[model samples]
Target chain A: MTTSNLHAEIARAIQAAPLLSPIANQLLQVTARADHEMKEVIDLVKCDSLLTARLLRVVNSSAMGLVHQISSVDHAVSYLGERLVVGIAIAECTNEFLGKPLDGYEGESGQLWRHELFTAIASRAVARHARAPLPADLAFTAGLLHDIGKAILSEFLRGTSRELVADIVRGDTADYLTGEQERVGLDHAEVGFELARHWKLPEALAQVIRHHHHPETAEAELRPLIYAVHLGDILAMMGGQGTGSDSMKYHLRQEYAEHFTMSKDDLALLLLECSEEFRKVEASLASLKET
Target chain B: MSQMVLGIGDLGASNHPDAEIKTYALGSCIAVVLLDPQTRTVGMVHIALPESKINLVKAKEKPGYFADTGLPLLLQEMARHGCQPKGKGLIIKLAGGAAIMDHNDTFNIGKRNLLAIKKILWSYGLGPRSEDVGGTFSRTVSVSVRTGEVILSSPGRPNWKI
Candidate 1:
């Protein structure tokens, strides 16, 4: 197909896919505003029974390690706070889109979601360590959606292009994102940005999805946030969290490592916490499967 | 067959013939495998970095995170598992240690890891029987205790015996 035709086809595929649930989109908007009222969040969450049930289930679940049962959305918000609760709500809402395999990336079923979850958890840890301007939950959200483009781009890379990408990435000096652009006319980061725009997500979130692979190229104000996601991505890869065939093919930004002074003990502790969070997320997911 | 997975900064050994010990998603990290043909024993260590001087506490706590410390710990565990540490029955295979990010050789942790492993092994007068190291691919490595077979696989690439 011609380059324009391929681009059009990719755009159509992105539109056809289930981008994000209405509740998740609303949560995204509410979470963007620092002064968002708790009552507004409670009211919005109450409108979706699935979101409410999942939130209550999560807070009461051993993942939260809370002995008291959160019987209502109000109690959940009060106990877990608004940002974390919204992060989980987003996880629940977007599970369908995030929880699948990307053949182009060579991940098994649900591997992408696992990777995203790890990145989100690790991103929060990096943000706190770096003292980034963005809130922990926002960093988590940005990390979770950093690879949404791979999901969209995978469809367009079904045939010979997949091999082309794999070969180029495996070469001595080729970067994965550049290889993607060369073969498919656009990279996953850029495609992911377009998807975020299509879903009407906040501008900061969209910019994050675009520049995560190349944080230095991002706006100065968003550099710390982008670096958090970038470092989190590397940490996830190092830990082998939900990685696929293309696990280590991406660029590693050592500049981020230089900016932060992380001891081995600190890294070990952060990863331990991330592993705990991963197990909790897995437990909740298992329960979701049961129901 | 049962499979035992070794995470980063982890080392494990087993004598069960039905067991297959594996480590997955190895980028710059290295998986060092030691197999004993006579006892059907297998040991593997997934080491992340080169040396332990940078983090003494972590190296003390989890020696498997570095080549200098992890390799010795793996060997000790192998000997404890009733395997001949220096006999002909011992077969060593190494996989992973790839420079996934090719921007420059400055932060080539994979190359540094390989060099460390070589230096440490040379001190013991031992070396790997087979290796699939370097390049820019992430690898999953497995060793079959029953047959002492070491296999390596990566995304979009063929799985082959090392």
Candidate 2:
């Protein structure tokens, strides 16, 4: 296929992002002034009691299902600390953002959130395997927010036609990117990347939006962690961990195994581990009511 | 004269010489397609992760866990099976990395994965004849043993014949 102009699309999205959502601005203010300092962030976080309640409820719910039962928000917070708290908060926030259907992703609604959550968990699992310094919670938080742009775009795609969805379901960054570039002069990925950057999400985290699709072209610093998220996404889709428009068809790179030194059995086992872990967490979190 | 199917980690490829070995829908994961004409041997790997830097025990348990640990074994598997790069002139083809992600997320494994694969291949002094790597869409790759012809297919388009 012809090469897609990621830069051009990114540029368009960057310019358009300011006109888009106030959420990016809101989150950035807290994260920046606070330097993402958890206490400060938590202070910002606390303002969203509904969000926190939702978060605590999910955490408590999921924990109850785990062999390690956690009953209270304070206990969960103390145990998981701020790192995981951010991930839970992100999950809580995005749940609303992705609540509507995404036209670009085949009218997928909340499917984005489900897909992202699975991917976030999977990213943490891979990070654990890689011995990356990122705690599973941190990796998960980054993974969870990796697709923030997509969430913003869902509103734009709210009432698009089935033909467009069909085209997207058919596939290609070109197909989906083209439509976005034509309409808003940028694709969601680029838009998402800019959103992440503006939010001052760690640059490493921002890279997820920039290169999640073309890991090969991602910034040099983010290759490994991005790869983990990538792998996590594949596993999540393959294992049916959540709903998504692109689940049934995909393959992995050979060097990933070579890069990580895992065999098929190893990959399979990792997948099993992810599933088991999610089940434990999900069982506990099932008590959470939607905000 | 022998048709060998190289199952490298999570990836598998068949060299029918008269047929093709194919893998589909690469998202964040990488698919390494290797073909040897003279040896009539072709193989592929559907690697799902980078390096096993996280849990070596788990990595050891699952061999398809890292490029460093898995690449050698793949070559060894090919060598042990007599599909060594002894002339049929090895051709490596790379594909996948369709993060296929939602509109707002980053989790960019596609771009990062292709980078890792490139580094490994460079270290090994090998690369694919062609590739359709990275995008928001999935891809399918098929290699014909007889002609060493590789075909890739994705949604909304026909198989990319090369």
Candidate 3:
């Protein structure tokens, strides 16, 4: 199929894809703003009783290890922070996409979610090292949704893992992203960008979903934030939390040095920290899966 | 037969003949597998980084997460299980330590991890008898306790004994 034809098929797929729940959409919009207050987030949660209850349940979940039950939504949201709140809301709305198996990559069900969760945590950590002020939570959100295109593109890529790997090995393609483009006429990043547009996600997040593999190409102002997610994505794969065959198949753009100042030791420490956080957060969010 | 799966920074040993020890999704991390055929004792540690000094606290809490700390702890666990490396009967095999495609060698963690493991083993007068390390792919490694058979697998690849 021609590249244009493939994009048209993906366009149709994005159109049929589920829209974010009202609460999730609102939460994302509110959190994307730099000056948004915790009150705004709490107010949004309070309006959706179901989300409020889920948030409270997660806060009091044994994974949280609370001494006493805190019944107030305000207390729960405060305790869990915006990241987990947004994570729960997004997971609630997009379980089908996040939880499904990536057959094209030979990934198991829930693997993609695990990878994204790790990336989200890692990206948040990387944001702290930005040369300029960057919203760590925004990076978290971007990381969480970075690979969403894979969920929709998996079926179209089914049974192509070997062919893709072979193409990469023989130098027919530079990397997995290129191999994906060569085989399917469109890469997951492009497809994900389309879905981001379909969901009307914040522009920063849409840019991240598209250029996370090559942050150098993103807009100069957004490059730092995109670099955070880019490094986070690599950190996830490096820590053994990849989706599947495409695990570490992408290139690590070295230009990240210009955006974030991290020495080798710093990178190692960040990986350690991300690994520790991923375990705790994954355990806490596993409750969301049960509900 | 029962199987025990090791996550990153985890280690375990078993003496049961009908046991299998495995670790999955080894990207740049390395799995150090130890087998003692006579006692049917097998052990594995999934090491995530080359050094422990980067995070001493985590090293103390999860020794299996770094090459320096985890390899020594795995050796200690083997000793506790009555499997000594002093004799030739002990077998060491390594897998994983894969690098992402990169020209600048930024985050050449896979190469660093492989070197670290080899250096640590050399200090202990031990080395891997077989290895399947350093690639751009993730690996799932397993070992059969009874047969001391080490098997390696990855997506779109056949299982091969290393």
Candidate number of the best lDDT: 3
lDDT, model 3, position B75: 81
Count residue pairs with overlapping backbones in model 3: 0
Q: Using TM-score, give the best candidate's number.
A: 3
What is candidate 2's CAPRI-style docking category based on DockQ? incorrect
Clash statistics: count for each candidate: 0, 73, 0
Pairs clashing within candidate 3: none
The parts of candidate 3 lying over 4 Å away from their true place are A1-5, B85-88, B103-106
> After superposition, which runs of candidate 2 have C-alpha atoms over 4 Å from their true positions?
A1-56, A66-74, A80-84, A131-135, A154-185, A241-244, A248-259, A280-286, B1-162
Is candidate 1 or 3 superior in lDDT?
3
lDDT of 1 by residue, A55-152 (tens): 77767776567766779789987776665666677677677777777777677778887888789889988888774355777888888888888888
For candidate 1, the C-alpha RMSD (Å) to the true structure equals 3.7
lDDT tens readout by residue for model 3, B39-86:
778999999999988888888999999999998888888888887745
Q: Write the residue-wise lDDT of candidate 2 on A44-129 in tens digits.
A: 54566664665566655535544665555556566655544555555444445655566555534566766666777788777766
Give the Cα-based TM-score of candidate 2 against the true structure: 0.50
List ranges where model 1 is wrong by over 4 Å.
Answer: A37-43, A63-68, A72-75, A78-84, A160-162, A165-173, A254-276, B7-11, B48-77, B85-89, B99-126
